[model samples]
Target chain A: MIDNTMNPFLIFISACLINNILLIKFLGLCSFFGLSSSIKNSVGMSLAVIFVTIMATVVSWIIFHLVLVPLNLVFLRTATFILTIATLVQIEEMFIKKYLPPLYKAMGIYLPLITTNCAILAVAFLNIDYNLNLLNSIAHGFGVGVGYTLAIILFAGLRERLMTAPIPKALQGYPVAFFLASLMSLAFLGFKGLFGL
Target chain B: MSKSNKPGISAPGTAAFLYGVLKGNPVLVLMIGLCPVLAVSTSIFNAVGMSIAVAFVLIGSNVIISLVRKRTPGEIRIPVFIIIISTFVTIVDYVIRAYSPELYRQLGVFIPLIVVNCIVIGRGEAFAYKNTVKLSFLDGIGTSIGFFIVLFVIGLLRQLFGKGELLGKVIFSKPALIMILPPGGFITIGVLMGILTYYNLKKSKV
Candidate 1:
């Protein structure tokens, strides 16, 4: 499954740019707008997304392949994915609180928010809907999360420095953010169509 | 959790409707659910279909959520919204698949993804719970229409220049590839937002 497939570099580029979950696909948007004000929080939020997405993908993959597929319960994908993600977030929250309290604090409210992050569930659905195997799913999840982190970090860095940048009267906070997202997405569009990896 | 800044609140209903259209703009101003917008807004027909589907679910969920608002616990309000939106989105998804397979193909996975759009949940939390059912319903339609109008405009303009046609025809010989790319979507929407804001500022001035 790993050796025989689409270009890994294309997967990375697609997740990061052409199929960007934020600017294009509109997944993980809550975190994009909420936690992007500071680089520290952006990193924390991105890390949290990475954790929830990877875990949720693995668990959901196991469930879908082991149980749902056999039962032909494909219609239940939405309900199942949502429940699995909520449960995953709860478990991760408890473990982090106990084993990594400082990191938990850094993530704080954003941790719980990951449960509602449609990106996690959306990626799982994409895996099944596209019928990718376990290895591909993991690679896809990792790539998307990294894509997410790249976007958040890029956005956070820009937004933080914007603290000193002058702006027009009405086009201050959100307008600037949206414009910046546009530019960043434009930059990412450059990565299209280079995948012989 | 709701920051109810209901100003002197005379006919807050109308104000809320207006807010969704411009002040709290879903696409341009708020920048929510842009994924489907940019992806589907290549043609007028696709945008119209997506808009109608979104409108149906948004209005349906808003009314349902408002009806259940009194019984819903605060701790679980969000989950409930999620479920309601998901259910409606699923229904739309299946119905679209069963009936309009062609449009379904065009919209692709985005139809099902309507569940995750922040605009729906945001509408539920911000307007549906606080207002009467009637107000909530109106607000939903108004906001959805506003969203639809914007998507339609963007789609129409893009198709016109990008493809040299309005819907799918090729009204002109030379089409602009820039209008079909990611950067094109951003530039068009950015300029549209600027113009809209300028008009908004002018109107508010009067």
Candidate 2:
């Protein structure tokens, strides 16, 4: 078990780099691959993931401690957390669409996708699993979002270049993308011993 | 390719079953539900456990959704499917915890994450909702088999190369430790996918 008493900054750094939710933990590959075809979509999706992951972490943390624990309903964690995330994504989508039209337009399509991103829900589960307090949970959540953004944006840049590269027809799309991700993940592996954590 | 069989119409059971196992493989083809595939496939045992758990949830949810499709409202079908899927996942979670503590530890959060696995929800939304319960059940089986096949092969490769062992039987003194790590998972899948694509392309040309 990870030490829950570790510094929040360390937690943030560890989450962002060492145990990156996407590259290391493999939490959110669907969107990682699906939305990474273009930088525009990657940025848009990253913003939405950042927003939803942090929000869902906060909400799930509160619900798990306050509602589920008190009611002795910890077994409902899976269902409740998913439902909470789905609902949060829905409400956030509507709120953005209604009041923040420009931002909504930027991330509208990605919002619905965030509901099933798994990273959001995984963050929620990690917060509880690691027994992190609210502050640490927030930090971890933000760190994961940042890590995802870093990986996807970099990958989008590579994929844009890949579009024009002469490649075999069979290995044109996803196969090549997976190879790219493999190299990126290999690079991220170098960050493992950072700070000796 | 039968002319009389239209695209909108669901395929027959045997075809549906074969489709997931071959043509429409969830991992290799549709490319959904990849998280668990790369994560728990470090060892053959973990892979088998995960496959069974996923099969349970996928089959349970697909069968239930097919049974309740007519009564379920279209606007809310997704949520209902999620609820049903989560219910099954929770059951699998507890069952594993009670039965095999080691696997329970290894799988950890991934067991719960099955609720959001695109393959489960994707199958629920795409196939089970429109098809009969029998077909959905077959699809669930076929898809799980597809998942199992890929996962087991990856696990076999990783275990053999990573630890110089298969099913805990050591075959060599030195192993490429990277084969069991995060990057190894990515690279293995990438190469396998590339090879499969190459084979398919070559066959088509022939």
Candidate 3:
């Protein structure tokens, strides 16, 4: 377990770089590979992911620490947290549509997809598993979002360039994209010892 | 490739089973269950363990969903599907923890993350809900077999290359560390897909 006094900034940076949720930890990759075809759409997806992950982490933290632990219902964590996230996505959809129409138009469809994205749930479980404080949990969640954003954006850029390259018939679409992901993961691994966390 | 046999028109058990193994392979073809494919494919043992666990969940969820397909309201079907799926996932999680503590420790959160695995819920929603119990069960088995095969191959390569061993027996003096890392998983799957595509294209042309 990390010390309780560990700096939130360090947690955030480490999550974003060294322990990148997508490249390093290999979470939320379905959407990462699926939605990284374009920069604009990937940015939208990342923003929605950022919002949903932070909210889900904070909410799951409170539920785990205050409710499940006390009631000895930790077993219900998987079902309850998923249901909560699903409901949260629904409510978030409605709320965005009603008050923030423009924002809703931008990220409305992507919001529902967030429920299935493993990164949110992964972050929620990780926060508890690491025994992080409330602030650290939020920071970690935010950092994961940023890391995901970084990965997707960079991947989108590479893919955009790959569009023009004369690729072989066999490795045209997904295979090539995955190779790109492997290289990116390789690059991200270099950050492992930077902070020594 | 028979003209007379079309999906939903004829209910062939073998057909459905074989379809999942090749045509509708969850990992290589459908690309649904990449999370477990990437995270747990570090070794052949982990690959088999994760496959069995997922296979159990997939079979259970498919059977139950097919049984209650008529009764479940359309509006609430997704949640109902989720509840059933998570119940099975929880069962597998506890069973693993009690019987195999070391495997459970290695899998850690991934056991629970099975709840969100697209393949399980994908089968529940796509095939089981509309198909009969027998067909759904067969589909579950076939899909899991496909998943297991791909995972095993990837794990085999990774373990053999990464650690210079197979199931803890050293095969080489120098192991490539990248083969077991996250990047190795992506590269292996990517190259495998490329080979599959190559063969698929060749077959199509012929």
Candidate 4:
């Protein structure tokens, strides 16, 4: 078990930089690579992820601590949490489509895709694995979302510039994108000893 | 587009199997379900463990989803598939924990994250949902082998360079420790992908 007494601020920084969900941990790469081709799409997807991940952390934490634990049904965590996230994404999409029409138009397409994003599920699992309380879990979730946004936005910007650069046909598309990610990942490694995390 | 009229075998079945292993490899060609590939591939041991676990879940879910495809309602097929896939993942999670605590610890949350792996669910929706049980089984095997092949190669390279060893045997004294780090994973995979694309492009031209 991790030390629960660690400050939430440190947790935020650690998750955001030291252990960035996309560049460092490699979670959510499908969307990281897919939606990151354009800055507009990446921003929309990141906004949706930020909304969904925090909500998921809150709900899953509550369920695990209150329901799954008391009922001794901890074995069902995987299935239960996935079902909850799937349902939540659906409800959130519907709610947004109804109330926030403009917001829905902006990020509506990415909601359904978020259901299978490993980052959201990984966040929920990490919250439980690290033994964080509700406040810390929320902080961690937000930090991870911000981390994802930062990486994807930066990546999209680079990819935009890459589109016009001369390149070998073999390395034209994803290969170059991956090499770019490798460089960014190497750069992000500089954050490892930050705050002695 | 060649159709097989040979007795006791079908062309589509062979095509399905070959597609996963070569044409539509989950890792190399399609680039889906890459989280585990990059995360646990620092060592061949962890890579093999992850491959086996994912293979089991993929095969199990594929077979079961193929079996129930006809009866499943079209509107809710995605949820149904998720449930089936998660069940197998949960089972694999405990089995690994009970049998090999070391592997379980090394794999950690990745075992559970397999539930969200795009390959398993993608296969269930794309191939298994419309194919016969036997063909789905073959597809599962072929896809697993493809996944295993890429994973094994990455693991081998990373282990050999990172630790100057292979499967716990020291091959050399000096090692590039960065090969085992996160950046190493990205760089190795990037180079590998570039090589694959180069070959494919050459093949097509020829």
Candidate 5:
């Protein structure tokens, strides 16, 4: 049952909206809390992450299957995957700078900030760490990254709006954001049934 | 190396270690790493196991990151950092699985999720990368203790009110189911954060 079409699609939607890596899984809380202050940066950071994640997933899959597995070096899976991601992020930064300098400036510190984002590293590890083939991994990368984007965008949209919303004095910043996350996680609890797939 | 103060101990090393456990306060001051704190604190046993596992990653990764911090070019530091952090995570995962499958199952996906816990990488980047090994080790202990303190409190509350017991002892038969569920975690952490903020504010005013 190596079905990629429907399963991948479901996985994407579910990961994005339901089992959101941020709200539920709590994968990349650092970036979620740190970079999500402004909607503009959130959008840029989200897209850059989505872009690099697809690339990292593809490359890491290849390395895991072709190099690590063959050499009895599976023990080094996490190390290799992370280093490769770091290297790929470097490549991405340079490529963006040379090719998309304008867009690069728009992304700003988030470009480098993505390096520490555990979500990015988590995706890389999941691609091979969970033993998905190239296609499955790609679907996962797309799914999880979109899932990340959706949550961040949604949160950013709300938080951006909240900038004007009358939040209580104590609950203004992280407090309110956390409360929202808690509620969102509760809302996401509705999606556990989709796992019937 | 850690035991004998003269072997590799230094002053700043002492500071970072203690800071992580208490002052920097991964659970309170840093106010990050709350995911595991909430999710895994449903039981006292889980809090204990997770804390130990986190301590191992903090110590090993902190030391390794500090050792390589200088050579890691600024442009590529982040990636290099991930590689290092993920490596230690994998090693811990394997060691844990081999020796302790029960704890592994209880931790569930969180053991792997440690790859992303900012406290581990945060300590690496913030303290370990610049300090000595001994100090990094202490930082690991301190941070773990802080995490342990937070998790223990949450676990105690959840196990008490949610399960009618502290560690399955059945202190009271009628427990609140909501307290053990996910929302309960948020509520508890929220109140805890408020109290911490209140204390911090009061202390500052003094």
Candidate 6:
């Protein structure tokens, strides 16, 4: 397993490009498709995801290693991790509403969806699955978020252009968007084995 | 589109089941659980396995949530629903792992992801919470059948074209390898959705 000895820098890059959470791992496709209809919303969603993934991954790591593993409660991971994420998202929402009113108004709408954005939960599980240490897990989380932002933003840009392009009536909305995703997935596959991670 | 969101008359079991199959087909219409649809539909075996697992979880969660709907406080209802759904998911996950280890291995992360499938929780919040236990049970089976129909078709096509096999039996001499890859999943679902949308539009026009 590349978990223990993999360098942090390499982990960051690999997670971003080589193993993108959306195109490759398919962790968070819901928002990738749902929010990518517009660049602004996609970027906003990505920012929210970046914040939540880092926090959720780190916290889940602590809970899994310090609490679950020690107490032989590993089976509770699926339940516990999701509960932790739900709570974290709730807290983040409350905090934003309390102090960062402007940010709340801008990105608050996407925060509630984060609780169900499999990417955050997926990252939490991946951290444990990969057996990454605390630092590595955080790096991986950040990498997944950055990769998601990069992919969604790029997609949003393409979609903005697609709006003007002539499309068949049947393929107007999601069908065309899905075809675009396939092309993107095909391109992303090129990054496979790039760093051999 | 309006029909998809309108609550089904859960009292009539067949009506509830048909509602799921045609109007609220989870994949083509509501698009609730596309992750599993796209990820596990590469083969018939995997597709059926996933659908059954989802059916088990959905039925179990729906029945349980309905039975306790009155007691499940609104403030913590979502969390309560998540825990209940995850419990069923965990059970299915272990059962699959124990008996059909191969299918479980093939499914990988998706089995666990079932805990978070929007359709299960979506139905719970939308229908089960407001309906009776018997109706919720039928609704679960209805939606599962609908989901199964989509999964089965996609799996059959993907396996037939992508691997030149159906349920592990050879169908074609040469298969289109791309049909089974991630992109293939997207393209298939996209085209299928397009066809379904076009048909529905034509049907509604007359």
Against the reference, the lDDT scores of all candidates come to 0.77, 0.89, 0.89, 0.90, 0.74, 0.87
Error of 5 at B164 (Å): 4.2
The 10-residue segment of model 3 chain B with minimum total lDDT is B1-10
After superposition, candidate 1 runs with Cα above 4 Å error = A1-4, A7-14, A17-20, A23-26, B1-19, B200-206
TM-score of 4: 0.96
- Listed in order, each prediction's TM-score against the native is 0.86, 0.96, 0.97, 0.96, 0.85, 0.96
Model 5, span B1-206: residue lDDT tens = 00111112344655655666555778667766766787788888888989888888887888787777778777776666677777778878888899999888878667767766767877776667667666777777888888888999888888888899764466988888877776677767777777776666678889
Evaluated at residue B108, the lDDT of candidate 1 is: 78
Which residue ranges in model 5 land beyond 4 Å of their true spot? A1-6, A128-130, A165-168, A194-197, B1-17, B64-87, B162-164, B171-182
Docking class of 4: medium
Give the per-residue Cα lDDT of candidate 1 at B192: 78
For residues B18-111, write the lDDT of model 6, one tens digit per residue. 7777888888888778778888999999999999999999999999999999998899899999999999988998899899999988898788
**Predicted candidate 1 versus true structure: per-residue lDDT over A1-197, tens digit per residue:** 12326555656566666677776665676568667988988888888888888898899999999988899987666767777787778888889899999978877567777776768877888887778778778877887898899889989999999978997755666556767877887777666554533
Per-model tally of clashing residue pairs: 1, 0, 0, 0, 7, 0
lDDT tens digits by residue: candidate 3, B1-206: 01122256245999888877888888888888899899999988899999999999999999999999999989999999989998999899999999999889878889999999989988888889989999999999999999999999999999899999875678988999999998999999999999999999999999
Every candidate's DockQ is 0.38, 0.61, 0.60, 0.58, 0.31, 0.58
For model 4, the superposed segments whose C-alpha errors exceed 4 Å read B1-11
Q: Candidates ranked by DockQ, best first?
A: 2, 3, 4, 6, 1, 5
Q: Residue pairs in steric clash, candidate 6?
A: none
True contacts kept of each: 0.18, 0.74, 0.77, 0.71, 0.29, 0.48
Q: Tell me the TM-score of model 1.
A: 0.86
Give the distance in Å from residue B4's predicted Cα in candidate 4 to where it truly belongs: 22
For model 2, the docking class works out as medium
What range of 10 consecutive residues in model 5 chain B has the weakest lDDT sum? B1-10
Worst 10 residues of 5 chain A by lDDT: A1-10
